[model samples]
Target: MTALHCDGSLTADRASYGGIIRDDNSVLGMELLAILRGVTLCIQKDLLRVSIRSYSKLAVDILNGIVSCPWSLQALKVRITSLMEQLQRKEIRHVWRELNQPADFVAAIDTGDGESFFYPPDFPLDLVELIKNDSDRKTYFRTPSH
Candidate 1:
């Protein structure tokens, strides 16, 4: 089984989405983009069984058909559904941000308007550390907002 964590980040003037840095300013859009990218990657690599984790409940709900996809996202919804049908087994789940730190870190990286695909050997040190901690099942505490 292939396990993937997906996330998206948005700021007032910029966005890092789906391993690609772009001008897309919608958070939910970015979240869906991440899932799409992850799912596509899995299919391309012939990973037939997959578990996808995302911190965006809305994105998870949309993918799971528990909620209606927004009009603006209909195309993305269709594409994701089409890709998911190719998988032999798949699960898309909503998780808390703390539990998805590695993906969040990747989503927050500035790739200078380009996409990044990190093979294990090419992962940034910080992301590598995060992945190690995740594999070790280390707990992360969420800090309260000011």
Candidate 2:
């Protein structure tokens, strides 16, 4: 199974959303966008079984139909639903932000360019370290940002 972690960050100056910069200020919108992009990438890579993790409980609930999707996000909801149907198996779960640091870091990065995917050798060193720590089940603390 392929595991995908996703996140979105909104700051006073700008928003780094779903691997792209957008004028939208809604953090929820950004979270949904990140999930959409992650799922889309999974499909493109022919990953049929996937586990998607997000720190937004609302986003997870909305995607799982546990909560109603807002009217503004109906289109995105529909698209995500359609894409999910193509998967052989899937699990969408809400996790603590600490457990999702790699994705959070990626979402916070503003490259000014659109989506980016990094493979081994080309992966950012910081990200690689984070992934290694996660895989090793090492514990770390993150100070909450205002």
Candidate 3:
């Protein structure tokens, strides 16, 4: 099962969820990502104790197609309305793919395998470590001068 985390959460208790839904349509990557965001947000809502206030952010690293494709664009808009209506405020932003390697890897596996694959939360320790190491390297290099 895939683990979903809430990026806007401050508590350690906020990140507990797992599930995989097969996508038979082989939807475009951006569209799939959009759907994942919506589903994850819905799950997040269930896990949280209180309502999420305005300005909560959901960052994603995806193609411009999310906004460029009419169908995908509309589908994504609908996801928020239908799935996230309970939340008072939220923001979704597209980040650089390099900053979101783990998520990219997960999506790639979903598409490349052509079949859904679920694993324990710690199943891919190596991959998770690689992402953590890359993030640390970037942080080190980007550290501000004294």
The CA lDDT of each predicted structure is 0.87, 0.85, 0.47
- lDDT tens digits, residue span 23-109, model 3: 322344354454556456556757422232211122232222233333535565455445544545544454444555655566566
Clashes of 2: 0
**Backbone clashes in each candidate structure, one number apiece?**
0, 0, 2
Clashes of 3: 2
Q: What lDDT does candidate 3 reach at residue 24? A: 22
Model 2 RMSD in angstroms: 9.4
lDDT of 2 by residue, 1-146 (tens): 22344578898998775643443226678898898888999999999899999999988999999999878888988988889999999999998887898999888778788877767788789999889988999886678789
C-alpha TM-scores of all predictions: 0.78, 0.76, 0.44
Residues forming the 10-long window of minimal summed lDDT in candidate 1: 17-26
Query: Judged by TM-score, which candidate is best?
Result: 1
Look at candidate 2 and tell me the lDDT of residue 93. 96
What are the per-residue Cα lDDT tens digits for candidate 1 across 40-138?
999999998999899899889988999898888899989999999999999999999878999999889888887977789899999999999989999
Tell me the lDDT of model 3 at 49: 27
Candidate 2, run of 10 with poorest lDDT: 17-26
